[model samples]
Target chain A: MKPLTTEEIRAVIAAGKLRDNLFKATGVFCLALALIVIVALVADMVIKGSDRFTLDFFLNFASRRATQAGILSAWVGSLLVMLVTAMAAVPLGVAAGLYLEEYAKRNWLTNLIEINITNLAAVPSIVYGLLALGIFVYQFGLGQSILSAGLTLALLILPIIIVATREAIRAIPAMIREGSMAVGATRWQTCRYHIVPYAMPGILTGVIIGLARAIGETAPIITIGALTFIAFLPPAPLSTLGDGSTAGLFDWVMAPFTVMPIQIFNWTSRPDPAFEVNAAAAGFVLMAMVLSMNAVAIFLRYKMRKNIKW
Target chain B: MQIHDNPTLKAEARNLNFFYGEAKALKNINMPIYDKKVTALIGPSGCGKSTYLRSFNRMHDLYPGNRYEGEIRFFPDNTNLLAAEVDPIEVRMRIGMVFQKPNPFPKSIFENVAYGLRVRGENNKRVLDDKVEHALKGAAIWDEVKDRLADLASNLSGGQQQRLCIARALATDPELLLFDEPTSALDPIATGAIEELIHELKKRVTILIVTHNMQQAARVSDYTAYMFLGEMVEFGKTDEIFIKPKDKRTEDYITGRMG
Candidate 1:
């Protein structure tokens, strides 16, 4: 084989540049297309729903008349469901991730668990709803309550949080672990002092993003039979204390719940065009909440990476 | 100091054999570490000097599937360190290690130095502050880092980080210290500084070091052990090992005739 001449080399370099530029342009174009669609949708929602985007809209309950409908119950329900999901998922997922990464030996059983967890992440969200319906709603006899809905969503996002936690834990270099171990720290102590703190930002980011996804999830909660219409707020944990009600803090967990997405779904399904506007407003609110959560996670990750050096 | 006919042994390895799954990483080995003295293990790469150093504290326990066949006995108690009943964590507390790379935790300098004490549940601020300062001074880094104790350890220079790790290890008041090519990642000046620190540290703690640099082994060690192919070929006074080695392999290695 002969080596390339200067002209041939130049031609090859030019061709490489051309191919690189073509790929870059193609990627940019696809990204721009997606961005355009998202902008168009958000803009349409804003224009259509701007009239209803008011303090009153947030304060009013669902009404028979679309013009008077508000998302007070839906937003509150969304907040409650997310609270349950975060509380249930974060610790459970992190513990499972820690066990898998730090303690579990490389064996058939661990490998099997790892594979199934990854597979579970890809299973459709609605399937989780069915599982929750079967277990929490029927077998456990918890019925279609906030507890059932929260548990179902927790299951839905469990795989995501676990995967993220593992990734975050894995990002820490082995040298840190060795450093801690060399100093005579026990396994649990090393994990608590060195590994977990170093990986906290990553873990929190994962949990927040998981929570964001859970906030927007409608199918699974709907499948678990979350009500689309609930005029009265789910009794707050302390709401009954000073309100002369018989309900206790424990009642809220088993009480019926309605989330924002379900409320949006219900409004959009109505025949009235005004109800469509209401749906758009509610959808905008949900989008804002999810995007803000993701933004906060991104900001935290940036700060953590900036402050921490290996 | 008056010399005794028999030196007090800090730790002793008896016919030690180590295996990494099916492949043997070390053969039968016997060596004694003297109290308050420095022993340097010298050999080329893959000669198992680092492996032998780690065996003393069982650093290899962090990984699975690695096995040890013989005992390394701790003095005073005569505990077989290689035995399953012996806890590696406890062994490590008394025998601290400085790795080839300066791996200070990503934390404040004070926190890094106090980590050992903190692990043992010493939460009193007064105790931690006093001990942390003492350790930093012991490692000869207090003069440089005294004012910046709250700064991130990672912000320090390579030599400073290594010294901070030394301080962290020393804060526990260990009986022995292991240096596995502790200066390999540093510049010549930093290496010289670490060598000086090692020389001073032997006054209070037993020291064992492994180094590929023959000059470094000769310069800093009181006794030298020459290893080749996972076996110790010669062990004697540093002067004798470097100048008058009896074994042909040791002679060849010291003379740069073979690696």
Candidate 2:
């Protein structure tokens, strides 16, 4: 075969560069498209709800008049639910992930469990609500309370946390584990001293992402029968109840609640145009909550990962 | 196998065989490790030198489907390390290892050295400080890191990180120390430093090191075993093996004729 002339080689190089530039431009366009959509949605919400963005909008309870309604009960309920979700899921998911990654043998049963966990992450969120309804609500006699909603969200995010934990643990080199064990450290000792600490940053990211998803989960919260208009907050710990009895520390967990999604859902469906503005404002607040949670994840991950290296 | 001094046996591998699932990695092998002496295993890649070294501390047990047949007798107690009832962790406790790459935990320098002692449940601050200092001094890295024990270990140079790993292994005061190509990842200066440290370390602990570098085996080891294709080709004093190898394959491998 004859060697290519200089012009021919130049043309070939130019063609390759053209393809590269095309792919680069396409990638940038796709990314920009996603960013623009999210930005537009947030801007639209903020603009439409500007009138209802006052301090009273957050201080007052849900009222008959849309202008007077506030997210006082809704925000509190969302925070409380998230607290329970994190408490339940972090330990459970992290422990399960550690076991599966570090301890479990490569057998059929473990393989089965592994496949199921990955599949569970893709299951509809509403299924978890139904499961929580049966197990936590009726079977455990927990009713439609904060405990039920939190546990339901916990179940929803468990698979995500488990997968993330596994990925993080796997990222740790085998030599580290061997180094720990070679010092006469037991399996538990290695896990406690090395594995858990190293995997913490990743696990924290997963937990926050899961909670962010759970915060905006309207279907599950609604399916589990959350109240849309809660006038009163859950009784504070050690505070005297209406019946003259002091509330227990965990009394809030069992109290009826209204989360942001349910409140937003209720307002959007109302007949009055004023209620639409309430929904828009509440949506922005909820979006801000999710975005702030993500920011915390990124910051914490950066801080914790600063010292870690292979 | 022959030794001019007839040193006391620290550990003995008797007819040992190792399997990684269905594949036999190490054939029947019998070798003796002298008390407080450095023994080096020299071989090419896929020759199972590292495999033989890992067997001393039951390092293979960490992974599933890996099996050990025959006994690796630990001296004094005569415990069969490869026995079914013998816990790998217990074996590991009595022995320590340093890998090819430096693997300091994502922790402070002090914590990295004190990790072994901590695993043994030594939590008192004074005790940890003293032991960590001693270990670091023993590994010949105390001067470089003594003032900054609180600094993260990963921030150190590659050679310094390796010495920190040595300090970590030394902290536990194990009877046997295994080095699997520990200096392979280091530069010439760092390699020289590690070689000198290894020479100094054998006074307190028995050493078994696997190396791809023939000169390293000759420099640091009192006794050298040449391995090829999962088998021990020859074992003798380092001087005798280097000067006049008994096996043809050992001679060829040493003379750079073949791997």
Candidate 3:
């Protein structure tokens, strides 16, 4: 074939250049679109809710008058529910993760369990809410309390934590295990000191993310019959005021409660227009809580990465 | 495989046959490992030298589908280490191992060496500090790392890390040490330093080293076993084996005629 002229070659090179720019521009446009939507939505919530975002809004209980409404009981309930969720989920999830990654045999039974856990993470949160309603609230007679709500949220996030733990455990080099065993350490002792410490940062990152999700969960709590108009705080776990005469730990766990998301949902659905401002304000508070939790996780991950080199 | 001259036999393998799944990796093999002496196993790649070393401490138990038939007997106790009633963990404690590559824990240098003592319930601070120092000194790395005991072991160079692993094994005071190509990953200088350390270590512990370097086998080991495929071709004193091998294959290997 005859060689093409230099002018023809220039035209083909220019066309390739145009295609490269098109792809790069498209990627930038997609990222900018996503960021703009998030900023706009957050700004809208902050502006609409600015008037109701006062200390009084945090102190006062939910009321019929929109101006008088506050998230006192909602915030408290959210904090208590999250505490219970973490206490229940962390140990169980880490143990299950460790067992599957370190001890479980690579048989069809373990394979089935592994596949099921992955599928569970993808299932709808509302499905978990329904399951909690049937089992914890009705069948077990936990009865629309903080314990039932916390347990429901725990089940919803267990798969997430376990998967994260497994990933963390898998990241460790097999050489470390061999070195430990070579020194006469038992399998459990090696895992306890060497393997677990090495894997902690990863496991903690996963657990915190799971907790952040648990804090924002509304459907499961709602399905478990958590009240939207709670007016009083759950009992305190420990009170050193006078001879232990105040609310005991049992009351806190068994008391009826409502979280921020459920409270915001209730206010938004109300017929009163003033309650709409109240709802946006509650949404702002909820978003702040979730964002702060995630920020902590990110900070911890950075510190861990810096402390470890290999 | 009967030997009556050496009265200080620390360990002995009799009719050992090893298999992975249905494929055999080693044929019936017997060799005597003497106390306070350094023995080297030199062979070409995939010759089962490392497999033979790993069998001493039962590292093969880590995986499934690996089978061992025959016996490895420990002297003084006359215990068959491969017997069903024997605890693999106990056997490992008595027979320490260093792998082909340096594998240090992601911890402080002090902690890496102290791990063996801590696992065995020696929590006294004074006792741990003493043993850690002694072991590090024994590995010939105390002077270089004495100031940075609290620093992470991963920060050390490859040679230092390997020495730290040796110290970790020594901290437990094992009578026998297995080195599986311990210097193959090191530079020539590091390899020389380690060979020197192995010479020193033989005074206190029995050493079985598997090496691909024929010169290393001659330089460091008191006795040498030349293996090919899955069988032992010859076993004798280091000087005798290097100068005049019994088997044609052994002579061919050392002289660079064939692997």
Candidate 4:
């Protein structure tokens, strides 16, 4: 075939540029659409709940009067349940991930385990609640308390943390491992000195993402029998009780709890329109909590990754 | 084997064979590594030069299903390095390695060199400082990094990083050191610096190096072994091998008629 003239070449180039511009426009439009929807939802919540943004709104307990209804118990329970979830999941997930990546042999058994773990991440969160209800609440007889709800959320996020850990570990170059081993260091030495530190940023990101997801998990929390009208907070770990007796350090974990999402769900289902305002305010608060967790994840990742390079 | 000037044997491979999960990579081979001398293995890609070099420290044991037959006998103790009961970690403790690319840990320069000693449970600060300094000086990179040992190792240039890796290997005072094309990723000036460092290093430690460059073998090694398709084609004094190779394949490879 004969070569094309300069004009024909220019025409072809123009067509390709047009297509590229069209694709760029399409991507920008899609991004803008998502951003607009999120912004609108946040704006609506803020405007509807503007009257209830006082300091008293955060300090009061659930009352029959809408003006007196507050999220004191709801926020505290959410915080405590998240504390349990993080404590339970981080160690178990990180250890399992480290073992799978650095120690386990490549065989059919390992392959089966890997596949099952991936599948577990996609399983419904409510299923974990049901399992916790059977094992933690009934069989283990922990009661429908903060411990059961926390344990349920931990189960729901375990797969996320594990998968994240594996990916973070895998990102480290093989040469680094080989370099450490060549210096007469054993397997455990290599992991402790190099692998764990290098992969810390990625692991932190995964942990925060998992916690963010668990914070808004209403289905699992409700299924595990969280109360919707709790007036008192879980017992302070070392504070004096109303009857003047000292509370146990671990007493808070066993107290019946109500989280932010459960309170919102209860308010939205009420007959009075005033309760709807409470739901909007609580929803915004939950969104802020999740966003702040994500921000912390991003900051930690940046700080940790500052020194590492390929 | 041809006669030499009665060099001391630091280690020897006796009927050594290696297999990567059923496919034989190194055939039966026997070669002696002389104490305090540099030995270079020269071959084309996929010719098992690296496989042979890695066997000295049992680097292959890190992966599953890679099997070793016969023995790599270590000197002074006559330990069979490839034996089932012999820990690869113990073998590696006496032998160190540098890879093709510079791989400094994401840590302070001092910590990078202090790592091997730390693994051996050396925790005293003064002892670590002296050893790390000596290693950096031995690798010929002390003056440039003396003030910034606290800085991250990854901040250095590629050549500096490579020399830091050498210091890392040298901090433990191994009996033998392995270089797997350590300067292949470097510029000509950096390569020359590494070659000079290797000449100085041979006074204290036995060295085994694998190289794709023929001229590198001629410049740095006292003895040379030519490998092709997992077999030792020739082994002799470096001058003899470069000037007049014994095997037809070795001659062809040296003359650039074949790979």
* Candidate ranking (TM-score, best to worst): 4, 2, 1, 3
Total colliding residue pairs, candidate 1: 0
Off by over 4 Å in 2: B1-4
Off by over 4 Å in 4: B1-4
Best by TM-score: 4
- Assess the local accuracy of residue B78 in candidate 3 as a C-alpha lDDT between 0 and 100: 79
The digit string of per-residue lDDT tens for model 1 on B1-259 reads: 3324477898988999999888888899999988888899999899999999999888899999999998898888899989998899889888899999999988999999999998889999999999999999999999999999999999999999999999999999999899999999999999999999998898999999999999999889888999999998889888889889999999999999999
User: Whole-model Cα lDDT per candidate?
Assistant: 0.90, 0.93, 0.89, 0.94
Give the lDDT of residue A248 in candidate 4.
99
Candidate 2 on B15-127: residue-level lDDT in tens? 98999999998999889989989999998899999999999898898898899898899997999999989888898888989999999998999999999998888999999
Tens digits of per-residue lDDT for model 4, A1-310: 9999999999999999999999999999999999999999999999998888988889988889998999999999999999999999999999899999999999999999999999999999888888988899999998889999989999999999999999999999999999999999988999999998898998998899899999999998888799999889888978999999999999999999999999999999999999999999989999999999899889889999998997
Taking the tens digit of each residue's C-alpha lDDT, what string does model 2 give over A90-198?
A: 9999999999998998999999999999999999999888988889999999999999999999999999999999999999999999989888888899999899999
lDDT of 2 at A63: 89
lDDT-based ranking, best first? 4, 2, 1, 3
* Per-model TM-score versus the true fold: 0.96, 0.98, 0.93, 0.98
Per-residue lDDT of candidate 3, residues A153-260 (tens digit): 899889999999999989988878878887777878978997777888899888888988989888888888899887888767665434557766677899999999
User: What TM-score would you give candidate 2 relative to the actual structure?
Assistant: 0.98
Q: Mind giving the per-residue lDDT tens digits that candidate 3 earns over B1-259?
A: 2223564989998999999889888888899988888899998898899988998898887777888999999987978888878988899989999888898887899998999899889999999999999999999999999999999898999989899999999999998999999988899998888999999998899999999999999999888999888898799888889999989999999999877
TM-score chain B for all models: 0.97, 0.98, 0.97, 0.98
The positional error of residue B95 in candidate 4, measured at the CA in angstroms, is 0.4
lDDT of 1: 0.90
Model 1 chain A: which ten-residue window has the lowest total lDDT? Answer: A237-246
Point out the higher-scoring one by lDDT: 2 or 3: 2
